[model samples]
Target: MVMAFRKKPTSVIRTKASKPKTPTNWLHLIKPMLMFLCLLFAYVMYSNWSSWLALLDKTPIRAYALTHKTQFTTNSDIRDLLSKEPVLKGYFGQDIQEIKDKFLEIPWIKDVAVRKVYPDRISLTLVEHRPTAIWNQTRFVSAQGVVFDLPKERFNADGLPELYGPDSEAKKVLEAWYKIQKDLESRNLVLKSVAMDIRGSWTITLNNHVELRLGRGDWLPKIDRFVTIFPEIEIPDGKRLSYVDLRYEHGAAVGFISQ
Candidate 1:
């Protein structure tokens, strides 16, 4: 027997939706918006740059101010110093940095720190350099090698050995002199001038112009050996030696200038 199949009926629904495309010119609106944004960004950057430039102009003066520290000091003197220069004033408008630079130019000022204290004022703190020693009769040399005007009162530096020769040898000569001074003090010997030749040879002078020559080689060993042998013998009468040379390995030598 043959089997047969039948198809099922289906229902259809309709919806209304009809609108003609209104010629859209979206590019026109977008182009204007992008241009406006670019112009705004440029203006912002320019304004920020101008503000920074203004700040820089005044930095020198603002830097000169004293910190909000001890009331014993005031900014009047600082303001006077800054106001004297019209060029500097024109460079700094409400800026304290230019003032600071001027203040730093003062010979006595060692260091300065500047701060922006908001609202209406700036603070400046100053550190003045203390004189270490008199340099070559006319100038003053600080512990850090900064040369300045000679102070009125002579500063008596404790145990600082006199420096001579070129500026290049200052550090080395100072160190060696101090070391030798300390050593001599321990041994009850008062050290005076520590002179070094251009060839780096060292000579020590004591009271009454007594010279002790330490030659080119290892000086500490030579000095040690001299110290050991120094006390043993007595010099012949009326023949005082001018200097003791410890350069030789076997023994020491003496120098005397005959008048």
Candidate 2:
């Protein structure tokens, strides 16, 4: 399913964020230290050729300390990704950006930070994603408007609105839902779902099993008209509200069904 970021800085975005919880990635925590020690060896080798051969066994890579808030990403997920990296010792102090670019390949990873330390060590920091809503019934969007996909079972989709729209219009569709939701609340209506068809028309289902055909092009005004007229609608005995066609230039056509 799709996920959106929530409450993350512009530089870091999204997850429920369906974020990572633990394991293997902590190796990434140690990867920098190893990189630093390896680079230090390379530098010493170049300067004095004699000391390089003496202390080759003391790998700077120490034990790792892992930190994660969720379990959306697993140990194997990270292990498999890191296995593909060219041995870190191959290039003299391996290109920092290149190391970062490699891990960024994981779908769940939002960003990676790399730097060199004073005593021949490397440091890597992995950024986490925060998920806000599910999109197109399959992906999630972050608070920062980032759209990415994750499996349905990986997150808690209990209360998020199922928003449907063209991939390019994800942000627009999400924003529209928020406005519609606020209008719905003022009416004390519970929203079941919101869908925006390929042509950009909008439809919403309510908890009462009533449908609102909001029509095409910006439905907020149409919904406002609905809020005003809804309470005044008369059921005319033994009938229940079925739908309201709100596409009119003025007013709306209300439909009813036999109860």
Q: Please, what is the TM-score per model? A: 0.58, 0.62
Residue-pair clashes per prediction, in order, are 21, 28
Question: Which RMSD does model 2 reach against the true structure?
Answer: 30.3
Query: In lDDT terms, how accurate is model 1?
Result: 0.64
Error of 2 at 182 (Å): 1.5
For model 1 the TM-score comes to 0.58
RMSD of each: 7.4, 30.3
lDDT of 2 by residue, 122-184 (tens): 565667566677876778876665678777787888888777777677777778778888888
Report, for every candidate in turn, its global Cα lDDT versus the true structure: 0.64, 0.72
Over 37-132, each residue of candidate 1 has an lDDT whose tens digit, in order, gives 999999987778646656655333333444445222246756677567744422324545665687777776777776655433456677766655
Once fitted onto the true fold, the runs of candidate 1 whose alpha carbons sit more than 4 angstroms away are 1-19, 23-109, 117-121, 132-159, 225-259
- Which sections of candidate 2 miss by over 4 Å? 1-71, 116-122, 228-242, 251-259
